[model samples]
Target: MRAAGIPQGTLAAGQERSAGIEAPRGMEEDSGRVKISDIRVKHIDRELDPPFDAAWDPVPRTSFEATLVFVETDTGLTGVGSGDTMAGFAAHAHHFIGEDPLRMVRHVETIESINFHAGRFWPLEVALWDIVGQACGQSVATLFGGTAERLPVYASCGDLKSPDARAESAIALRAEGFRAMKIRIDPRRADEGVAAVRAVRDAVGSDLDIMVDLNQAWRPAGDITRSIDVPAARLIAERLLELDVLWLEEPLKGDDRQGLVDLRRSTGMRVAGGEMAQTFADSLALLQADAYDVYQSDVVLAAGMHRSRQLAELARMRNRSFTPHTWSNGIGLLANLHVAAGVGAGPYLEYPYDPPGWTPERRDFMLAEPLRIDGDGCLPVPQAPGLGIVLDPELR
Candidate 1:
């Protein structure tokens, strides 16, 4: 297989059609042919007892849980994916019940028809891609035209506590082999955000790359009460630049295209956003306007593997950087990792590493083996067919 980022044509010419391995028991016909005879989508709710922190907003404290959507083909092969929702992903499943899991783009568009949808259905789409890749006996990355076997990863910590706590966390993550790290900021006080960065910088020294997430995109009704205005975000970006921050993420609302463009012009630090956006059109608009130095798209949130791949390709055609957001559980991380591995030049994959809440074990609670960062702070792009993740039967 050709390395990721190589032209798709190059990979296609040498791509392995199928491993020639037998399909799972139920998926093969009496003639021994493999075909998708059925599609079943189900939601698995795994709870996070304590809600993750978003200090700027006083939203109700709730459990952290994932609505896992499993696609089971008639052949007995299964592909797994996870979605994000406060009440769980029940509403999103209504649109995916009997659709072809392999026709991912069409599946996503069908689900997008639901009003109030946030593109969470993309996880289901990702699972389908996983299934299709497995059926074809190729890795998901290869399916996306990638041949690379590994990708860089960075630590992403949520919860805004004292600067010292943030600094200590950064140090620990560095010791654990993360070359880069990100910290969430208090949207109400730009100065406090700067101080947090300064403390981490001081603790980790200048060599470690740092990024700050403003999370201004999805301000719930409660956060609206304490949201920072555009001027305040601009000032914060300026200070972040002074601190030598590698990038400033989502300082403006997701839809404030003009504000993002202005912020990029006002600050030297690279500006990043788009995790909350749901379509290729939104990502294209952001890129066309030069809204950010890096594009942050989440596979699960951007409506699945097909659409996220399309966005990454758009970013590449425009000579922009793309790094997927990874705040959800391990399945979400895996889904994005597959996409990033295919993209070739994406920035570090976001690895959620906050302890007491979002540790690798907790984040991957449902999986048999948690994804671990290598000593060099990179994860081997999964070579297994489909998503390359094997869920524990017990966990299921």
Candidate 2:
């Protein structure tokens, strides 16, 4: 990956696909001198036509809401990003108002400290990376360590559908060229969820890899509910293994380190999790405890790209899979895609798709155009500078 201030096409050997790229105009003039001119956060709520049944949310789902973060540089380059609510960030915007956009580490550190009193500030960091990529005339993936411009994607269904419904969706996704599909398993009735997985497997007949998400790692604030215990998780894991599940996701609470470790060891199923891990330290603790076989952290959640890159590298070194959870909005998905591309495709990237309600068009409503999936179930990483997306005027 090209470090800060490094010219394009100068990456060293074995550095994924970096080559034959010209630097942006006036790059030297702008360089590290460009400061953050402004920061804006927008909370958007768009109603979905068909209600999306999110497995974890206790309430009925109708519309989707997201907060977008934009960081504009003094040189006129703007980067776009999205994440959790930024309700507490308006007063703290001055912390980054006049800072250098290219000082990635400094910006990351500042946000890390500011997070104690602030909300999700990683979006700003993502926006800074976006600005740097735009200023350098390169895709953020190239700025990171990615060599490939496209990666295979799996259709990650968000709704808690019935066995028959899930089976039909699986067949449709397979016909659409998706190599894999993820099913959301409701812990309340995990038995039915397992049946749904079985039905999808039988219908697709091994043409696609199946992943099941328990979503047991987290819930809404002020809700201290328990989903499953170790014995119950073991039973579910056994059933999923028998049905040829590729990986079992978030099978227990985020803090159930020993439980996760034991489940992975005993069942031999790839216990995939870490999306709820908010910081590098949290992930480090999980890693130290051998908490998971696959790390599914979201780039927008806590790590962002700065710390996420490190987590991806660590996963690679430890011979573990690093597929990010991309269930958020378009910008958030794109941010995770850049990081996942940088790390190289392990199995498949998460493509949030449950049509009628959670279609790509609705999920990516803020973008100039919806990020469409190809016949081969792959998404071409945007080549345009920054996060490779121009926000819709309506959203702006």
Compose the digit string of candidate 2's lDDT tens values, residues 1-396.
466666687666777544455534443355558888999998888886567767677776778888888888788888888876777888888878887788787778878887776676777888888998988888999988866788999889887888999999999899999999999987779789999999999898989999999888988887789769878899999999998899999999998999999999988989999986877899888888889988888888767787888887888788888888888888888998888887784688999998755888888888888887788888889988877877887877
Compute the lDDT for candidate 2. Answer: 0.84
**lDDT of each model, Cα atoms only?**
0.74, 0.84
Off by over 4 Å in 2: 1-32
lDDT computed for candidate 1:
0.74
Best by TM-score: 2
Residue-pair clashes per candidate: 6, 1
| Least well predicted 10-residue stretch by lDDT in candidate 1 | 20-29
Deviation of model 2 at 278, angstroms:
1.4
lDDT, candidate 1, at 107: 65
- TM-score quality measure for candidate 1: 0.83
For every candidate in turn, the CA RMSD to the true structure comes to 8.8, 8.3
RMSD of 1: 8.8
